[model samples]
Target: MGRNTRKRRTPLAAKALAASAALALGGGGLLWANFHASAHESHHDVAWGGNRTKASTAQVVTISCPDVGQKLTDVPARARTEVAGELAGLDRQITDAYRRLATTRDAQARDAGFVQNSILQPLQDRRAAVLDRIGLEVTRVGGTVPTGLSALATCTGSAADRTTGGGQDGGGQQQGGGQASTGGQQGGTGQQGGTGGQAGNGPAAADFVDITKVQPNVPAKPRRTRSASTGTFTTRCGVNTNKNHNTDNVIVAPGVANGAHHLHDYVGNQKINAFAGNDTFLQGGTSCQNRNDLSSYYWPVVRVQDGSQDFDQDADGGGKEGNVGRILTPVQAQIKYVGSPTGKVVAMPQFLRIITGDAKTTTNGLANANAHWSCTGFENKVQLTAQYPICPRGSKVVRTFAFQSCWDGRNTDSANHRTHVAFADAGGNCQNGFKAIPQLTMRLVYDTTPPTLRNGQVKNAYAVDGFPEQLHKPATDHDDFISITTGGLANRIAKCINRGQQCS
Candidate 1:
């Protein structure tokens, strides 16, 4: 990652660097489905920011020509070769960063708090910034080069249409190249998934809608950051302020720590998965280092509690409603989703909305994380109080109903395992567009010894279902669970159903 702010591009290597720069800056790919150009308008009057003289639209066409027929036969071949070389160097740098992120999670684990907070995080930001900068530069040169190769120009229609960046297979070339260009009145917004072409004159069409700004993006982030303060303390559980249990915060009780220990079998490996730092969050905090405190990762094992009273005899006809009973813990659960019936598990879309909005260096040792939980995990099972307005109008939102699944070492075969505990909805119900679902799925599959029953007689159950176990028809199973704000509310429920009973 060398900073190339040096304005001096060796004259010979400028063109190729410019072209590659366009891809990096202009977002060369069609992923930005939001921005589109007008249809069939080829006026060639695009305002090239740096240069004033209008370049012929034909030059753009030649620039897009397949490698075999590239335009600019006139720009000395030497300059093109040099530009190509420099671009190769930049590509290598980008690839290196991705490799570090994808494979170095463990290495990052060894980093001290300051290194993780100050150095590592900034490196990630720099990578993203460089990507955007290069993309913008490439677009600038792309805009200019095509105009110079007018003879090879395959572009047609009004200027707006040309900007759309979509067209026929002229010169037998592939279509993806330029950055997204807008063709319409300056700043009017367009709805999601809609398409319209604005012409050079007449009424301008709506502006492009950015998908990144509107879709549900699930991030695997934790509620709290790790603390070097308590490198190796052994507390049973920890407690603090009751700031209304926010969806983003985590609260642990003393008994729950014992439950997690009992279920997982192994007491102290450090629940790194839950305590790791999350890039998605603006603020990171310290963890309770006192091992005796009782609020470590394993301390909060998901348990099956009773919640039968949550159901109504009329609406549910004596059947279980959304909130029936259990604390869904993340001991060994894996929640996923998908569209096609290809049998591949589809990843449920998730969004973490930070509640406090105020950035803090830490959660101050004891406080519920604040944030909104929206996803398909609880689809069909739980209900929503208000409709989620941000998503594209028709996107189907489904969720896996919440369940308390624990990760006991029953399946010693795997590093961890999970089981499901049923819960009922307190008051909400499902609506037309949205569905209720579970936020976690615990798994366990011990005994990897070579089995003689490969003949299909003995089914290979993951086997993590030890202390917490229950079964139901696919539709009636306890599907989802929600977070409570205060320890008092949770304690009240725990007392009402002392030994685990249906509240009714």
Candidate 2:
């Protein structure tokens, strides 16, 4: 495969202006029984359709809106760049609106209808304009615009009452299990304080659960048959000791800086950013011990909210955006490629990009959520999806990501960045004209102290970086990958897996 040097012209000034205006605003658990509702489904009645008289007391915590990018499944190839830029603009609008809300709490307290009139409505208007541009771009490229694209323009405010509780629909309590306490106040003296995590947006007390209380939920592994490919190929990408960190997302918002709205800890490929083209990736250096594997692996940085500030404290994606704390470096980052259980696996196409989890799961729902949080010693016994696990003493935090293993065998990417790859079904068989490809799994371990609850306040709480409105919830945790493996190395990996041998 050859590197694609085709570059799309993006409006850098327009994106930068949107970001500047946003700079001003700034911004678990699977306890299946304790699962919270998606942002759209969890809005408090008083904040949504109820009388405005009650708005005086209702505290707007975050913003929730339909994810326009996810709905654009049929975008034409020529229009993708323009449409993506418009999608990113939507995010900037939300960020700016959230910042306005955060800084005007006094106004909200005085005027019952302040939030609805001053913040959300303006955001909706801004988003509507962007959505119109997106539609025009699609039509210009001879692609049919997705129906109801205009309906997603309206944004809503999520009140604190609905967002703080353990279960969104359960009204601050867990059913069947013990009461899900809305844990303590923010512990750190950092910029975060007031209602939620140190940053004041999320990781509420209700967002954590004791591992001892969670039942063993790990399902039994699928049985491998005689024809199953049982081998594994491990790639030794060292922990990001080099600290190759940034706040850019090339796949989603290429040419837009701070596109992720949160810091990312990167490993594997040394050259990664919003501006990196395919040629840059092909010529980039690698952190992997095997130079042939120049694949990139990255995820949002996890931070201890203990009154600390990273380099981005006042930067757009940092404290200004409500992401504040000391970033924790993972002690171990294990990257492995394993075979399919149903049949032999094929090599992944070069430059194939895969995002393994949903960064907006809090708002978009759990249909695509794949976050796996557990303690080092108790991973097999308990895995959490919505709440952060309170690991026992001496245990470390673990995050696991299993990438999609089925490919469409055509496009290397998709309009939504997801339709090109799909997860295998319950029987481990690829469906819908997709072919089985080597499965990529990552295990990241971190050495961190468990947060303590004292006097109804949490101390040393840790959280993953996220969009300001997403509130740093564990459920929003996600990972990104791009396969830049040389043909020789990819072939070797396939050979190792087909022969049932383990190789590096």
Candidate 3:
């Protein structure tokens, strides 16, 4: 059987409190795209991005010990001592591995420096190897060791102690029995204090894999585009609409009302009025419901490829121009007729909603792979707040924030509620739907002692025993029916047997 090499992330409830703290920090700038916040490009939520899937603990245990017994069963008695010594050495290595992992976790919390290659992964791998060797030796010796024997064993008896001894699996610890794997599930919340936290003059520890850098396919900075629609507007100035898209006919004037010489009724706060010929036009309120609307534009700093300037593709053009870009309001104005006939003018925001993405692609893009919803069901405008990563440790994990909307993909809402935004790839893939989307994952370094038998179990012989005294016990090395170790010896042996069968 081929070895499983993938690492995954498990969501813990601890993440929520951390997020809340960040939010209270008044734009900690770690969650989304805001003027005052840090860019959280590394805290990506999609799987394959920072959200890499984690493997079950049991599977990792099996992987750590791939060859459980063959190495020592046939050795001479003189070499048996050598084997025992080697097994003891393995036990110590496993212990050290776990201790180092705990230390690493503490180091990450303090923002101390450490690399995945030099200090973290090697220790984990070594722990796995040592546990494997011990598991094999224990299996060869026979069934689970008696309570008395356990006292003499080389590894920690407690599961957590065994795990920290080697730090082998990605997800927390493996469960005792059969259960579904949780490798690719979205992370719930993480613990408070962020990163690994502070460690006193205690044991050394290691940090988990920064999920941000896990996938090569996911981009560090995604491409975005922004476009605006021409809309009608009404202000204290006179109402005017040049059929031509040119701005030549628009005029700005004081909102203050003059004397009866230029009589006019002020609409709302508007004091200026438009006149047709010599007569003053009786103007009413203006609503630009179906009229042209004013627009705004914003371009972002793009993450370059190979240090070269390229096309800025990620700009989602949906906001108003300049000052109006952040917040949009409905426009109202008055329109004067050419005939001087008494009439009212109403102006409303021509564009009540924003449609994002490249016009060419929005009409047609690759199978909805990169389009994320800034808004919800109502198409309400989304106010992007902050975006940045949790940690920049080698992996490129990123998280983002915005005032959640009603799932309308809009910005206008009568009733205030919690905001919910959907995340997806830059290509337009959404987190919604069936297929598991790549997000973030942590490369956890943990140790666990392999399983050992409980005390007081009845022992049995290897040879057949159904018959009477005529049935003879087989004189062989395969006499034991169980084993005792800090790793998964039976699983490894089974794997090796299966592989041998395949080759045969």
lDDT of each: 0.20, 0.69, 0.19
lDDT of 3 by residue, 1-504 (tens): 122232332323212221221000000000000011123222321111111222111111100221111122333333333344444343233323433433344343334333244333564455455445544555566523222322222221222211221211223211101111121111112211111100110011121221232222211223322311112111122212211111100011112111011111122211112121111111222222321111111111111011121111111111110000111111222221110011111111111111111101111111111111111111121111011112222322211111111123332111101111222323333334312111111111111111111121101101111001001111000000001111332233223322222110
TM-score of each: 0.17, 0.83, 0.16
TM-score of 1: 0.17
> Which whole-number lDDT from 0 to 100 does residue 267 have in model 3?
20
Supply the TM-score for candidate 2: 0.83
Best by TM-score: 2
**Best-to-worst TM-score order:** 2, 1, 3
Q: To one decimal, what is the Cα RMSD in angstroms of model 3 from the true structure?
A: 33.7
lDDT of 2 by residue, 367-409 (tens): 4456778898887776666667788888999988888889999
- Candidate 3 regions exceeding 4 Å error are 1-70, 108-116, 119-504
True-structure lDDT of candidate 1: 0.20
Model 1: per-residue Cα lDDT over 46-150, one tens digit each:
221112222222111101111101222222222332233222222223223323332443333445353235433443454345434433443545522334322
